[model samples]
Target chain A: MTCATRIAFTLALATTALVAGTLAQSQPPARYGLGRPATGDEIRARDIDVMPDGRGLPPGRGTVAEGAAVYAARCASCHGKDGEGASAERLVGRNEGDSFAFATNPKLVRTVGSYWPYATTLFDYTQRAMPFQRPGTLVPNETYAVVAYLLFQNGIVKEDAVMDQATLPKVVMPAHGRFVVDDRKGGRAIK
Target chain B: MKSSRISRRRALAAGTAGIVGAALPASARQNPDTTKVQGPPGREVGARSPFEKPVRTAFSPARTATFTPLQDLDGIITPSDLHFERHHGGVPAVDPQQYSLLIHGMVERPTIFTLAELKRFPGRSMIRFIECSGNGGRAYRLTTPTAELTPQQTDGLTSTSEWTGVPLATLLREVGASPKARWLLAEGMDAAVMTRSVPIEMANDDALIAYGQNGEALRPEQGYPVRLMLPGVEGNASVKWLRRIEVADQPFMTREETSKYTDPLPDGTARMFSLVMDAKSLITEPSYPDKLEGHGWLEVRGLAWSGRGRITRVEVSTDGGKSWQNATLDEPVLPKCHTRFRLPWQWNGGEAVLMSRATDETGYVQPTTAELMKVRGPNTQYHFNNIRAWQVGADGVVRLAGGAA
Candidate 1:
């Protein structure tokens, strides 16, 4: 080994050592051995959140026809006779024709069809908190049917469409591409 | 301390007088001089003085919300009972003995911790403010355009408390959170089964899985037994009655984060995950319903806070926004916590307008409603932290003015 080659090798070793030391210091501390390991059944029972990409979706199927009956029996009293909204928020509206004019016009209402960015969110929300009085009462198929009815009323889906786990996620929302992540970083911008 | 001593002396004098007055007829007991006699013995639990009444104003639907009585409160730490509350489902009664928290998904070892086990971990106490993003929406949107408003009615959805809990970082390490995890779905055990997607950075930061508030077991309304406390984040994201957390690579896009909490923009795009609250201050005193008594010299008092960092300064304008003067910030102005501010004003029995603006550590000055409307438009549903204005008439009556009106 030449003298210059030996020097290069020594410098490389020092750099590697420095990097390794920093990585070790940055790693999380050792666990405190608290809390028991969760069983698979317990995890599955509580892990009910469904992501936008269809993860965590339960197996179920429902048609628009089935949804209409469920909507009248369960949702109409609060959401209105035709999902036009009464005591609760309006659930059906596609006004303004894709203009996204809600920001400029205060009178324009934000209904599920015109504002919601994902169909999966509709299902996720309905199954978790619906009927306003008795939330989490809707079975998987009822949740799917109610979602299909809402989407159909909003003019996003056809009356003949059958919504299941696969198709529910694939149903594109009108407001799908209208959301942007928050960009304000707390320095002088009011936004 | 001096004020408390004076009040005690006055009460003693009143009690002495009541002794002489207590010898009246039995029929006179309708307005009994109870101070003359021995008070009731201590019981298993205590209650507030019956004469001191400060109640929360609850809105409709029974599940909507209740506003704290900000005008009746003093100091930075809001009493646990008076803390503002917003619930999707009416507060659920959960048995702490049967409660457990599940942390799973994208972790080397999924774990479930009972309330007792969670308390066994090292504990940390912090003074932080939790605020509803829609706090001042009624005033900001001019929906309630009236000068007849109290501090509670105007902006009472924010409150501070000394929260004690185990750090979320400790729990994450216990579960061995995987490197691929970028978000966690926090789910509650309420009727609504409330859920929100919290960024992983917050878990690594100062997040807490709190079981205690103001040195007592959590109230059922405040998520008894357990709750996920993300300091400086919107209250909705800090899921209460916390039952489960699922670590994931991306946001869950829960209904709260998407259809509910998103802020609409003028550019036709609603902002998702707009979490951190901006600098805001409200002049609680010398506002509507608080009349000046002779008005030789009055001190204006209020609270200022920032989600990003400490409140660096609070500016007061006596004559609307035409001129400004720096107000004195009270001691222990902790970061991401409420900071009390005050300024002395001399009113010569004339009409004047009062306002306050807070500047945070990041040099972000609190904006007016007009300035915020210029950027985000008037329809942005949440995070309404704008300057408020109060007008004092020559008749010594104060009223809400300018900003919201």
Candidate 2:
């Protein structure tokens, strides 16, 4: 074969190989094909997490008045009659005028109002793990009501204010913007 | 002081005498010759020798934090049963056959993998350490500081194990995780339904959904059936008895992350997602409660680990922080795992202070207690990886520095 023809054939082969490699790279990964597709009902049953933006919150409405009753009946025993901390952590009270002195002052109490960055977390944690004895038993309405009661006691929301899927996420917490991402990067610096 | 020393010597003599006499049970004291009698047949399950008594201790009255006996352990792997446990909800007896993990949210195919199906994936095993961010806080914070503190009591929330499981990236890929997905929220099935939001970068990195630990099925206390193991991250973020994982574009701001795990800073701003454990080391031998019989050529041993990378060096300071010497690191010093360090010292029986500091591959040196406190403030809690000082008295008794003997 002529030298030019031989070079042309080699160039064609290399071009084909590059195209094949690109195609293979673009193709989707070969799945193990082991697990089955989850049903909608199954996903819904366990997808109970509520985001800061109220994404996973179920439709429910509750008022401070209703929450007070629920707290007395179900939560007051362990959480204290006034949420002043009994067997569990204190859920009430916020030092309104005091500066954020938790890092320096040992006397600062971290309650739901003072430290929690999101109000929706109250509903999420209460419904998922509260009453200490019986967890995941509270209905959505009860969870909302108890959250409202704690918020009210902590001087966050007004007594007549209602807490629901829409309003709970909108409740701006005092500690909302007080948090920063981790800055320590494991260097010579102590921090 | 002389009378006390004499009494100690008398007590030691009595202990030696009792070992061959009344201290032992009748069966043990009489059956000195094992070759004279036939041994019992092997059992279905095995147990540790009755004479060997290593136990875990609950640090709190609520039994929320069960600590591993660090002083009693050697090498790296913690016995599966004795691994440290911090359960928000109590251990749940999950049936392996019925257990399933649901991965849904921003995925091409939302799927459920049963325990049996998860085992079918190409498995990987790794030796890694999982440390609670709060480990060593008591000593570093100087709260309830005492010379009587053991290595276990000071820092026992960390444990190492050979975990066998599938990489979380593989599982996420199998589900066709979306390119835009930046976070995944892992939820546990315990009564607390413990949940934590993990960054997607970590998920696609060295994260493992572990099932087998130390060559056997995980104990219930260590999350039986299945659990997420984020290498080098805080233990709480691993999410034991993992039930669900939801891919998301933003963090869920779960209770654990927002209200509990976040570290409050001296500047009035709290730091969240402080997951990686810093490099730290402490001499386990010649620590509190371990009295030396005599001073001579003795080997000082301890463990050093880092979440960022392999422990590049461990420095031992026999003269309180004035001078430091590098300790020899044991072999198989894997990244994100415990590396044993040793040093030989000639003790002159004079009063001395002993301490160790670790430096990781990232060039991060474990800070001294004063340095750490200066940066983090006296009131901040968690991630206390400060250099620990052990004081050796003239009588050869070791204790925590600044602590009363």
Candidate 3:
């Protein structure tokens, strides 16, 4: 190789190594942004997480009796009057019957009370994502009301059971054990 | 950031004012629908082919995407006109002269760039696939076929393009993003006022503010003037007719992200924002309406992709779900890009089912429709990325098959 070409080749090699090293030094992608080294203010604004332990629970309260009224006003039409998975997602319901493993058959199926691992995911997702048209429009109280109504529909909680910041996070759905965080091909895959 | 000079080679692309995508040879154009397509014989101003030219059908308002006769396609890259389209409301008639892109929020300079300004930046052309997360959702039920799934249930997303546009990072830099900017709020111009929040880091990584599609200015259905192109992420997040770019400290928790894009899992919780369509493969040939005519020499072709990464392999099955074989995957297996795969089969003239499955670089194997049903639950409506099956009846007609279709 010519002198200039050799110098260029060496420089290119050095750049590749530096880039690779930098990427390798990064922290593991903490699941749910939970373990990531996030500051308190950043967490408050960006996290939007409602932990199952009720740690991140906002200062709010809504009785199931009160929630029914809230659900009728802010949620019913799209999520079904009772959260029974209408035109929108089947927010409430458990799928019974066979679970699959290795079966390479093609089909699409999923519901709320079957596969999800964390309840916090449900709350976090809803707070940041829902109400197909007017998202993030719900306040903390409304979110609790909707969550309570949904749990009632799934038969996990009694219709009259009031769900507040203290009680909401502790109410675990039955299938929580069924979900193994995808520790399959990686540490993320909970095989 | 180099000097802008029109070279003879780039003139057709840059033919010194010739649009970069207008590089098609204007001559004897080929018929995309026919078995044997012949391009413009030569030296004709309007000559074109499927690769660089699409048959433009006039419309009160033209559709953003056209469907390829699944029967006619051999490999991936549906003839541009034939690619299917799914847009909210409808395609808007955008006047490029009035188009402008506003880039603001958490940036050094909250500036606006007109369509012309964006076009002046250096451009990169890349081939990619954008399948709806739920393209084939209803394949799980076998007993009650039509009773469970509708025709519209299939193919909710379609089309692939050799897109040419400016990298989103370039624009972000020009605007000077602040260190705190983490997510970007993207909005569309359609009636739905389509909106979604994307991680700004992704834009800085490989996203693009595309103004061109398949070698031309934006199609009306596609976001004309400009659209956000986040390769490998979910489709809805790539807002078309992109109107606003607000880089912020966190995701805005928009409607699309909250109410629509998520899939409810089985355990009384929702699988939220499960973006990046899992790896999937489907045979375009020998599929619905494509008759084999009592079996003979048949060449099987299909498209495969993954949001996680490049497709590393594809396997085909002919004897129901009992046996399988690897197909030839066309190279340059680009990440978030469509990879065409093919296989040859001699039909025995009996009842048989054909299917293809793709595996991506991340080793996330494409799940059969049945396997997916197990993980997500049975009431799925969105983000259904599963293997597809095409049943070949004895007489030669093909229909979506059970198990994997």
Computed on C-alphas against the true complex, the DockQ of each candidate is 0.61, 0.66, 0.05
Error of 1 at B71 (Å): 1.0
* Highest DockQ against the true fold, candidate: 2
lDDT of each residue in B1-405, candidate 3, tens digit only: 111110112122111344544553444233335456653355635533424422222112535333333433445565555555656556767788876667666776666677877777767888877776655655554454312221223553645777779888877777677888888878776655566778776788878888888887867666787898888877878889986777778765454554457655665445555656677777766566445654466777788887777888899999866788999988777888888888888888898877787888877777777677776666655656667777777776566766534
lDDT of 2 by residue, B1-405 (tens): 111221122222112232224544566667889898776699999987655556678866888888777777788788988899999989999999899999999999999999999999888999999999889877876644446777778898999999999999999999999999999999999999999999999999999999999999988988998999999999999999999999999999999998998888889888999999989888887677666666577777899999998999999999988999999999999999999998988788898888999999999999887777777777787888889888888888777775211
DockQ of 1: 0.61
Error of 1 at A153 (Å): 1.0
lDDT of each: 0.86, 0.86, 0.63
> What is the TM-score of each predicted model, taking all chains together?
0.89, 0.91, 0.62
The candidate maximizing lDDT is 2
User: Where's the lowest-lDDT run of ten residues in candidate 3 chain A?
Assistant: A29-38
Worst 10 residues of 1 chain B by lDDT: B1-10
Task: Give lDDT: candidate 1, residue B159.
Answer: 92
lDDT of 2 at B216: 93
Task: Give lDDT: candidate 3, residue B97.
Answer: 82
Off by over 4 Å in 2: A1-29, A96-98, B1-26, B143-146, B403-405
Positional deviation of residue A112's Cα in model 1 after best superposition, in angstroms: 1.0
Q: In terms of lDDT, which candidate is stronger, 2 or 3? A: 2
Q: Lowest-lDDT window of 10 residues in candidate 2 chain B?
A: B1-10
What are the root-mean-square deviations of the candidates from the true structure over C-alphas?
Answer: 8.7, 6.3, 12.6
Candidates in descending TM-score order:
2, 1, 3
